[model samples]
Target: MDTILWIIAAIFVIAGVVTIVRGGLIYGIVLIVVGLLIGPGGVSVFS
Candidate 1:
């Protein structure tokens, strides 16, 4: 479970970085938010 979350987080982080570098701040923010949500230590997961 943790591993899966980590993988998803990693992918999102990478995507967010790419989007940011590509000047897509909105998309990067969205991806980062989604990544945080998908992370193992996120609020939803904690609750």
Candidate 2:
């Protein structure tokens, strides 16, 4: 489960970067923020 979450987080980060380069600034920022919040070292407030 942990590994899966990390992988998802990585995908989100990459997607965010691509979105930003493609001019989807708001979506990109949202994805990146979500990624950070759920990433490996992120704050586990919900967890």
Candidate 3:
């Protein structure tokens, strides 16, 4: 479960970075925030 959360968080963060690079500021920030919240090391919404 932790591993899965980590992978999902990583993907979200990476996608957020890519979105920011592509000129999406708000969406990217939201994605990053959500990623952090869902991460096992962070808030872990699932846990």
Candidate 4:
């Protein structure tokens, strides 16, 4: 479960970066925040 969350978080963060590069600054920041919140290393939503 932790591993899965890590992978999902990573994907979200990467997508966020790509989105930012694509000019969606607000959306990108949202995605990165969500990713961090969902990750076990941070404050996991599942918890």
- Candidate 4 on 1-47: residue-level lDDT in tens? 99999999999999999999999999999999999999999999999
Evaluate all candidate structures by whole-model CA lDDT and list the values in order: 0.85, 0.85, 0.93, 0.97
CA error at residue 34 for candidate 4, angstroms: 0.5
TM-score of each: 0.80, 0.84, 0.94, 0.96
Model 3 quality (TM-score): 0.94
lDDT of 3 by residue, 9-42 (tens): 9999999999999999999999999999999999
List the pairs of residues colliding in candidate 1: none
The digit string of per-residue lDDT tens for model 1 on 1-47 reads: 78888799879978998999999999999998888888887744543
Give Cα distance to truth, residue 42, candidate 3, Å.
Answer: 0.6
Using lDDT as the measure, the top candidate is 4
User: Considering summed lDDT, which 10 consecutive residues are worst modelled in model 2?
Assistant: 37-46
Instruction: After the best TM-score superposition of candidate 1, give how far the Cα of residue 3 lies from its true spot, in angstroms.
Output: 0.3
**Which one wins by TM-score: 1 or 2?**
2
Best TM-score goes to which candidate?
A: 4
lDDT of 2 at 28: 99
Whole-model alpha-carbon lDDT for candidate 4: 0.97
Worst 10 residues of 3 by lDDT: 38-47
Record all residue pairs in model 4 with backbone atoms less than 3 Å apart, i.e. clashing: none
State the number of backbone clashes in model 2.
0
Candidate 2 has which clashing residue pairs, if any? none
Off by over 4 Å in 3: none
